[model samples]
Target chain A: MTGPPDDETRDRIDDELPDGEPPEDAPDGATGDPVPVADGGFADESAEPHEPRIAFYGGKWASTVPIVFFIFWAIVQSGVLGIGDTNGLVIGALVGTILGMFLVRGDWKAYADTIFEGMTQRVAATAIVAWLWAGMFAETLQVGGFVGGLIFAADALNVGATTFPAAAFVLCGLLATGIGTGYGATVAFVTLFFPAGVLLGANPVLLFAAILSGAVFGDNLAPVSDTTIVSAVTQDADIGGVVASRFKYAILAAVPAFAAYLIMGSVLSGASLEGAAALRESATAPGLVHLISMGVVIATAVAGRHIVEAVSWGLIVAVAFNLAFGLSSVADILVFTTTSPTPAAALPFVRVGETAGVGGSLYSGAIGFFPLIVLTLLIVAMAQIMIRGGGFEAILEFLLDSVATTVRRAELTMVLGTAAINGMITINTAAEIAIAPYIARLGEKFNINGYRRANILDANTSALGYIFPWAGGVLVGYQVMVGPDGLGEQYGPEMVVNPIEVVPYVFHGWFLVIVFLLAAITGFGREYIPDRISEEVSRA
Target chain B: MSRFEKFLAGWSLRSSTPDYEPGDVIEVMVTGAEGDRAIARIGDSTLRIEGAPGDAADTRIRVAVETWDETAHRGTGTYRETVGESAF
Candidate 1:
């Protein structure tokens, strides 16, 4: 007869167990003490080691005030004021953090430490690291003339005005999915495809919407996507499983979206093709070689390689392709030259040179995400404070007890809850991290599959993030449209598609949300992994 | 399961019936207590396990199916072994 194991015995047992799979006899769940699974460890954000009491606020409500304030401020700043600046969001978040300090009931030191801990949490850092790698890889692809290659392909295909939008939709979706960043795809398509589409006499609004719809599709399915990563990591699901399980839903929505784009493209074709020849003349065949680079990333990721390894391979291939094909100069791919004796120039990499600033697409691409990375860290910190303060618990309790009683209702809550949070939050990835724990908890209550939970979470997040005018994805795309480097020079300010104008035309995003809602109600695409735990899926 | 059956299965909630059969392998977590019989949750339905190793409460383990009753929405299984901690 084996007695209850001692601490030493337990330690030995723990060491013998597989990396992510805990021993079969370990105490877990509602009855026994919850054992943390390494792969998709259920780090109950609201149940951290910190003392729950706040210094001055009344219970959990006061502790939750900061999160509520931030949400309200976000809505007012981005949604109402239409100032979709990351700097402004940073300010709002900073102010909210300060206010949270005031509400804490404990020693100021402890509160400060909590804030620091939240800022540097592994979950937040993991996403940021992935973003940096993704940004660099995406920028590398862009520098390798991936967009030019796409244009070349479109031109070679000789797609008519009636078919261009639908074709563009497919191409952009493929590009975004390969690159794992919808925002990058949006900017690329809006800059390259938009002008070409207009030259071919396609309706600009429909074209713009089609581009955004493609972005939505990619964000929903891309294995390297930030939202996909957050949804998977937060729900303790594997990226591979999340990507696979979501295929059905993505395809279901995409078929309709593709048809809609084709139908709209035919009906809305009005351009006279006055400058189509010139646009076609500028497109080079060599640019299309980057498609192979995109293919490498997709194949590597599907083969279960680490995301970093996969993207790194893609980046290397893209850079090599650029150099070998003479698509872009080495200097243009990565320039360190800077003009004027500024503080930045003092740095070893940025000595005085003829160029006023960095000229390389790779340099700009990686640095472009710096503001968002900082924003993500701050938001996660704020989330940590809210979790430690018991805000998440209160919300989860209400969601599970009052709202999500049945499995179907639970799934619906997961979908709608994620959508609502994403609609309010400008940064979709941030919204995903904030609401992921709730989705995991709610889904787990009914033993919902990790892939299913991640699918539902990411699908709604991707849709809402792009469809809303104030959303970060839409705003970023709009900025590109208005920038001097984009449509402003080619077609003037009049040709720039207003973010709001494109919202109604984002048929795919709206359709995706509806499809998921229906899926939840009718139990479509819902699967359970029988005896398998979420960690297993997460590990895979 | 055939592709058609799998497609139809995705449309209905798993908890609506005791769908497991004999010799099937499943992962389950001990969710609650039911006298001497340990109650484990698989998907949305509960199963009573006889002669569970130790206290089954809260532990996740693989189980081999033995019997099930559709009307009662309950099933029985023999504990194969423990797998890991519950994800929830």
Candidate 2:
């Protein structure tokens, strides 16, 4: 009786409503005509059955008020004031959502239901799952002294390897871009390359920035990237053509960013050669065994396995390596210590310690992202509210009717509009999805080809997601730097880079944004609908 | 276009209003509709399609161009058939 209604009761309930549409949270292709969603907007009513929409006091524009306030709050908190505290962002999102309820014109339940709809969205869930698994893997490697191993190996090999920030940039960029995951690559690189470079006399801030830049490079161009796919599909363009057309932009930014990292790497050698030599003494050969574990993840991700599966494989391999090679004890990787461990002391993961706690790499790794994950969910909920309430549509309509009267103005509108949305919604892919319809509609209006539209949509989304302090990519990377058990306590305070500090140094992110702006103004990469047809089928 | 050509595409400057000749059959999305007419705005060029369904907005349809004025950047077309619907 306390549960959801039974079939018979549900039928009765459905029959009672005038339109027979329930007020359930079906934001994503749910029971009714597909209303706009953060990932995909406005499914054809002729194609799908839709739910009744929740109305606001002032039409669709009213739906965006709460999110608009939240963005203003974020701008004031993170951008204008330079406050990087994520918890503050959480409070901002909460207050913003509360503000939304007052704007609902009809039953408040519809508004409440939309919150649940957004919270349950697959986009938020995907990020949470990947962050959790990646967190554990990162910590386990740290426990195994993977950083020290990298330092010793780089020192012995005498090749640049982890000693050079430029090398780290290239490697991290290749892995992330190739695999289509900037966040995952950032975690892996920060866990491996960040400390290795730090100990080998590279500037810690520069190293972190290089890793973030690498992630931006990959996320913008990766065919398998969610942002890329969303941009392509929403714009009605083939993924292959979109990728091909955007190549020049990616490379244009990358080449200079690469040189910047190289020059900056040498000039900003914050650590002494003597200090690096002294630090390498702490490393041992056994620690290097975890490279196999690292390889497993990079390989699986490149093979296009689900991120969860790839990280799981990496976790398994790392644990096995730690056990077989004696790099770390079982209790160190996963220990369940209780007030009285007598009963479970015999268990492999159970150990008697002075303090009673769940202290292990896996546990701590996942624990680090708790605040960030909460913030991500709340932010995504805000994006969903905007979509359901018509704020997204309002923004697009404004751009189309008010700003984009000419061809040049239209392209500029696309560039600035995408940036504004990505800037507001901290989750890059969610932002891209939410803005895809606008991009498609507006770009189509001007006959701006799909390749240019997709490129514009993704480049801004990818770059902004990593650039901002409150952005998911930046926060996720910062969490790892905070010693998300994957890298360990040995990393300490010196290696940590505040999310704000890395902003200027994320060379590729800035470079990419600059390229799009230039392209828009000069029409460098502009194409028309008559340019050429994309492939027959949608690659995405 | 070939793989190598993709890298070379869009090198030259493109016009604001592109022209499509008469008898050209093109597949385009009907972005909006007014009364009995449907519109497909390509770049700065506008195409008014005839015999399009009332619900043609946001749906892809095939059209045969009837006439085009290059200077005016506008054209008229006859709707052939519905090709697809909006992706979302």
Candidate 3:
């Protein structure tokens, strides 16, 4: 869908979009002519010139209570307290929404309904769906020995510790580009590559940052990414065209970032590490077949297939290869167990056990993201509340009226505005949805083209979401590091990189945001609507 | 355009108010409506389009440029027809 936003992209995105319905030819009472909502309003209809949905008890500013409260809770819990439990964050979000309900002036039913509406918003659904699919696919590949395959390739190439982090950045970027979800990439790399890299003596913090950097690269450039799709749809650009136009900027930032990792990988080394050659003992050449699985995903998505379809194909191929090659069995991929007496208990996947349970790569992979998914939905609902409360309008009006008086100022405002919002919201896609309308309005006022606007919007959203200490991407990787079966359990606690320590080293993210700021200031790659026509709005 | 060309589409810093000669037919999404016409704002320039449909707002349309005032960065165009609808 990100590749072209063809019918599949639009159908998947439009139906679940937060605003609920597309603007139709609603007649004006006097003129009987069609009244247009503000152009390109995707989510958060409050971005349009609309009457406030509800008046908060203490005024419109009180609309921010839920999200702001959650933010402080996230900071105190995750930052000051160093607790990265996702369920704890979900609890914080629930409490914040409850606090918000009390602040509503009118019927609390309206506030509660908004929460339901917010939870069901299309943008959040889009991301949540992608994660579910990607999680399953990645776990299957892992169980099929994809990590051992990577290590085998490294062994064959003689890529030692000095170059492992840089190598990881490239491989992780390519995998993320294929899968089209950086969160999936983060989970995969951390689960497999992180420990491998540490064994090869790469610095833990730098290796972790390099993994996140690669994710930023792919999320910004892959046509299948949710951030990429949202950007294109909101800015009136085709997905394929947006991918092509943004490549130059992504590469510009990636070039220097790759070199930094290369140089730093040599300067900093992981303490208490074994010889690099020892990793080969854990890898077998037979495991390399999963490369074909990863390639199937990339090739299918590149061929204009929907990400869901592409990943499904990859999952099937990985499962098949695992069985054919004896890399994993049916029980490893998926298994069901129950204590109840049943004739099905003798089946390979079914086991008579002490407790009812579903296990294996398929179930575990999808189940791991359950808490994160709830957190994302709650956060998006909070954003919707702010939108309905007139908070988004208040911010946009202030920026549009005063700060965006000139073309240069307007561009700067767009860049800063995107960074500011993504900085607050950890999930990049949700942040992009909330800010898309503002970018459209500001860019249109100055006649900046859709391609440029989309590139700017997505680059900042994608970059900031990984670099922050409490960002979803970082949390995903950190969770993998400390999980019961993660690096800490396998290689001791010292191998884990605290989320905050990796922030400064995510060079790609910082450079990406900086590149947009520079582009805005210098008018580099700036396009007017008349410069060139985007291929078509309804791409096939 | 070919796929390769899409990658190299915007490599330069374009002028804020680009000059367009009369007789050039360009495609642009109708940003808004004013009076009886659709308005397309391109950077610092604005083109007033006549014969745009009543529901022309936010639609893709082809327009034949008729008059250009470089000093004011304004122009007038005759709307050809509706070309496409928004993807969303």
TM-score of chain B of each: 0.70, 0.88, 0.87
Write candidate 3's Cα lDDT for A11-119 as tens digits.
4323442355421211122224344423221222322542346567666667789988998998788778877677898999999999998977645665787788788
Model 2, residue A254: C-alpha shift (Å): 1.4
Candidate 2, which segments miss by more than 4 Å at Cα?
A1-85, A99-107, A156-163, A266-277, A284-289, A339-348, A483-489, A536-540, B20-25, B30-39, B47-59, B63-82, B86-88
Better of 1 and 3 by lDDT: 3
| lDDT, residue A96, model 1 | 82
Local accuracy of candidate 2 as per-residue lDDT tens digits, A1-540: 001212453344335443655433323344455433211123333332122255566666677776778778867886678665667878988998999889775457657776877778777887788778877887788788788888778778774533477777788888776667788788778877787887777888788888889998889888777788788877777887888889999999999999998888777756443345666787777788887887787788768787788889989999988888888898888888876649779998988778888988888878988888898888888777777665675566666667777677888888888888887778888888777766766676565777888899999899888887778888888777653343335545566666777778889999998988888877788887656666754654
Off by over 4 Å in 3: A1-51, A271-280, A335-347, A350-357, B21-41, B45-88
Per-residue lDDT, model 1, residue A169, is 86
User: What is the C-alpha lDDT profile of model 1 across A239-351, one tens digit per residue?
Assistant: 76667667778888899999998888888755444455676667667767876876787688657676678768987898898888887777767767756677865543465
Model 3: which docking level applies?
A: acceptable
For each candidate, give its TM-score against the true structure. Answer: 0.72, 0.82, 0.82
TM-score of 2: 0.82
